[model samples]
Target chain A: MTVPVPFLLGAAALTLSTAMQSPARAQSAPAPQIALSCAGCHGVGGAGEGSVPRIAGYDRQAFVDNWSAFRANARPATIMNRIARGYTDAEVAQLATYFASLR
Target chain B: MTRLTRRAFGLSAASAGLAFAAPATLSAQTQARLVIIGGGFGGASAARYARIAFPNVAVTLIEPKTSFVTCPYGNLLLAGERTLPQITHSYDGLKARGVNVVHDWADGIDATAKTVRLRGRATVAYDKLILSPGIAIRWNAIEGYTEAAAEALPHAWIPGAGEQTTLLRRQLEALPDGGVVGFAIPPNPFRCPPGPYERISLVASYLKRHKPRAKILALDAKDAFSKQGLFQDAWNELYPGLIEWVPLNKDGKVTRVDAQAKIFETELGTRHRVDVGNVIPPQSAAKIAIDAGLTNETGWVPVNPRTFEATRARDIHVIGDANVGQVMPKSGYIANSTSKVAVAAAVAALEGRPAPEPTVYFNTCYSHVGPEYGISVVGVFRPSENGFVETPNSGGVSPRGPLAEQREQRRLEALHADAWYGAITRDAFS
Candidate 1:
């Protein structure tokens, strides 16, 4: 179609955005591989150290469910209840696996 | 063989030439130029649909960001489930689909001149303008927390606005055993209905593994949250000691936050200092909405629910978090869904056809409590006597009880969420 130049450009810009967004085919670290700073409180084994509960051996389903609950405000664990609400479902899964794998 | 192929190519070329020259032969009698401000879910979708429905239409999308980073899934990044790049998408795909994406900030809309002024001397004229610039921070809403203070105690309200998530994540990592992370939940009408609680879950999930001793303090303005019963059960069953939720009636309202000092003040003036603070301030429509006279006394655009056309302005449609659609939560899913309906109506109006009747839109907001555990609310909505009303018995919050099917449904919904994001982005840009 002989579209107007501006509209055509607009369409192209959006297409470019989509092209830039498609997930990468090359598999890499799915989550941020920053220094394992969590060891201080969590311990190296992913076991619960103190007030924090044991996250390593927990059920992945339970972890995901809990995070989802926090986001939905379905669950209430003061700071955790609030903190859990901040992550997307995907992030919750990534974290669940990350902590789960530490076991 | 060569002669036949050449002849066929020549015939196709001539037909294409005819098509290019015949704008009048298409649907629109008067070729109109549409300038769209912002390339978010609402603006991008409107641009694509407008171009498709009206072949003679000229569309331009002005947005400064090179990439459209979605806020819907950004929470995943905080929980350390997904990286920022996983949720980030560029405008390249939209560009390929024949959208003129202007990589510039929209300074002002010359409604009288029928032109949009850009930051640098650039300008674009339009017949119909669509502004879906999204919500801006009301920094003055909270005391002691200004734009600069946000650096230390990031609200992370605006997607990619600052480094609140990163800062909070980093601080959470560094916190000693028993460190407290305080989150001040804002009043209703914020962007996401269950967002504050979701953040709490992700943070708690992180702390449950790392700093088990650390606690999450959720100070709320509301008496209850979106899915209180389910979250409470999950927390108690999973990380009982790691979390404690304080509601407004129970002295949970936070009045002030000293960002530099890392202190939070309750309504009764009870001070609870913390290591990390996430204060989501009260919000309204972005400044441009107010400047354009599109917002009402409540500082949000009041639009015709069916079309999303601004009630105050002529031929201008406002969608996304900036608009006040009471029936719908100001979530990204709703914004994306409403944009489609608005686009259909806008297209019908241009073609001199009656707008579609009884538009029913769907919205599903999924949140991750830890990882595999997920909960969601799916609502199907249609226009009612007063405004948009949820379809009866079609959708509700995930059940509070225990079952494999419920969690499995949530897991599938997680994958479905990715596909939905992909599809919506495709519809908007591609």
Candidate 2:
């Protein structure tokens, strides 16, 4: 089984964002439970660590576009492609807004 | 961004503060009473999220235990990597967050009265009730296996720190070198599909160090299991010639056991005498769910995929292992995720607001094959007309491959698993 390169890149981006943000700003509202699930891989607040990317400050439009691409199979993905299909376009937008609201 | 209306503004204000003070506009409405039973991952999370999501609503968690010992990492205890204290969690953090933590058994649910009767306590009324009462062992599913038999053979399937788990560990320790250890794995749809295999791996890990000559025989009811390839690969690589798995086709299904003689008989009529026997009997929804008539003929509660409300009872939602027909596996992650969705719907109903739609659920199950070799499976699901379906291309098992990459990835996942344990436990209890 090969780990998807795009997934790793996405996680790396989250890690970069985590390093740039202040610890205080990282401590925000309690994430809705769905988003909180990401903490296992994306770090607390989606800060990202090591290979994971910083998703907390992602542009809402970018977030939506990425997930939409994954859902549509229009992007190179590993697990995200399958995960993205779990939500409707509206939920993707809501999640994007949720993550973007952090910073 | 949509402009915040008065109601949305009040909700935002209420969420911003830790105190359970409802906004003036929201306080005028009837006080909402949300009672959640069985303070496991699902119920505890529902209680905490309801407190934060709707401060005006009163959240009460009815659990018999003051502290919970999670099943997530209980295998580590068998390997002597972790102690009981490390996995125990207190409900004080939940109480501090304005949740009423009631220590009592929820004996029965009076759905008509919208109340839950407690053992030796007053009945608690609820506008919305969430039941996460995990699984109940089907005592007689395997002939000769009963509650009394567990004390001798010890299933250790349930999440009790000093009880079943400790008993199993003590049994393993007392076994002499070269003693045979046997496990009778249940059929499909059991809690934590990958769990028994993980336990087998950990037991092998322990025996490898303490009793290098000891052997493990796993008689499984199913032909395949979660992450089978991954687990088999790790067993071969790490503890070669130590573990043997017998599938159902080979008469792996255990029919009966003589606890006194320490012998297990399988469907093939082959009896195996072992020094230690770990029999994970068949399972169903907890007794409370069956008693309340929330469960179906399948012995699992059927629920609306969208709201997780019981099909038979209005205002009562079931999440966690008790709920069935969901695409998601019966694991802790799914329990936590479904709990949030249930809480969100319940709060919306209490406030007379439209429920949120297009909900997404996620689950990632990490199994430690050894101290450093971990594997995982991920799934993302959405409600469909029939039931919940996995989002295509979203979830899959951990990658298998070149030894170097596999080893590194497994090590990283082991670390991630620990982090996940902390994050999820905190999410539920703290």
Candidate 3:
């Protein structure tokens, strides 16, 4: 599904055409909006909590690599494997950047 | 910088809105009005999130009760593990955060006029309306059971620190040591899918401690239920020979109740006499939703999965237990999670911006079978062409086994359940 480029960071870089790009193509969609839902389990701003890990300010490449591995079934996990498959590689990159930008 | 306080997060969200200035089509308004009904998990979450995400929006939450007692950990109360005040939360926090917390019953909604008529107050107008009115019990669904009967044979399904919960707990306490406690479990699509089973487990926990020889007979309408395996596993290990679950095929569907006689008659003409009866009848969306013509044939409101906008109504969003067509369960966590999405979408629509795409929804239901014994089911969903689809392999019930690690995890999950109650209520009310 296509998500309009979110009006986060700034709208200066966006146009009507750029905003209409599918989520797969719009690799820079603001991460904070998507990351807000994660706060329930992963803690506020992905800062982590008891038993649940903190993803805020993680190495972007490492975050992408781990999610990719989970998506590809190369990693064993209880819930992350399934969640990883829900996002495209580009969306994952955006999420990694968003989390890394948190701290 | 390392740890973001809620105040800091709220500031960041407000700044994000100011930085972008929304879309060009948005009205040049200093304030927009957003009204939410039902002050429970869903409505409260929407009010709280809407206030933070769009600081300028005038958010009003209409609820008849000043405080809400959650159903999530209510079973623990029956087991005597927690007090009512612990599960109850006041709306002062939401009020302090700039949400107009109106303590009134939202009686009617005029979709065309964009106004909600309250029971004893003036009608409140809104630019956007969110209805999370939860579920209404179908009184006649089970013969011989009505509102009055609930006083004696309590359903205890609805959230609140009310007489129903207290009645059920008192009955359990008054039951004899070797007496039978019977439950007439409702069918599919009811609120808190695994609630009856959890109640059974907790009641058994109380019985084992106070009335060691007491037994529980669960008569279910459906052949299976959520986290059935995990519940059964824990029951076997925790309270063996104390609980018996009868499925529909086994004539477990209750047809009528003799509330005075304390007897439940099943569909197959079998009658079971018990010391206490817990009859959970079928359910439908709250009456207000039906009155507003928002619910479909199934007595549930169909909505655009991405926006939670009522399919048949304009400018009104129906969420929580009242909404259908989503693969997610009608659960507290789902209601809380979906409310945020609904609020965000409503804000975007009110601002004339396209709603966020690829909306991700999450639900984690934790059921405590006994002290330090819990099981859970987790799911992540994204909207599809038809409705919301659970992302494959992303969610499942707690792993089942006799392994020590699995047992430890169950114990930890019980602790997490307590923590989750604290966190979610804070997220919504505080």
For all candidates, state DockQ relative to the true structure: 0.02, 0.13, 0.15
Query: Per-residue CA lDDT of candidate 3, range B40-84, in tens?
Result: 989998998886666656899999998998888889989998878
| Position A37, candidate 3: lDDT | 64
What C-alpha lDDT do the candidate models reach, one value each?
Answer: 0.67, 0.80, 0.80
- Lowest summed lDDT across 10 adjacent residues in model 2 chain B is found at B1-10
Local error of candidate 1 at residue B110 (angstroms): 2.8
Q: Give the per-residue lDDT of model 1 (tens digit) for A74-103.
A: 874323443344344565666677666544
Q: C-alpha displacement of B183 in model 2, angstroms?
A: 0.6
What would the per-residue lDDT of candidate 3 be over residues A12-93, giving only the tens digit for each residue?
3223324544555343334445566676667655667666678888899999999989888798554566567766667687
Best by TM-score: 3
> For candidate 1 chain B, which ten residues in a row score worst on lDDT?
B1-10
Per-residue lDDT of B174-277 in model 2, one digit per residue for the tens? 99999999999999889999999999999999999999999999999999999998899889888999999999999899999998998989997999999999
**Model 3 root-mean-square deviation:** 7.4
Clashes of each: 93, 16, 1
TM-score of chain A in every predicted structure: 0.54, 0.67, 0.67
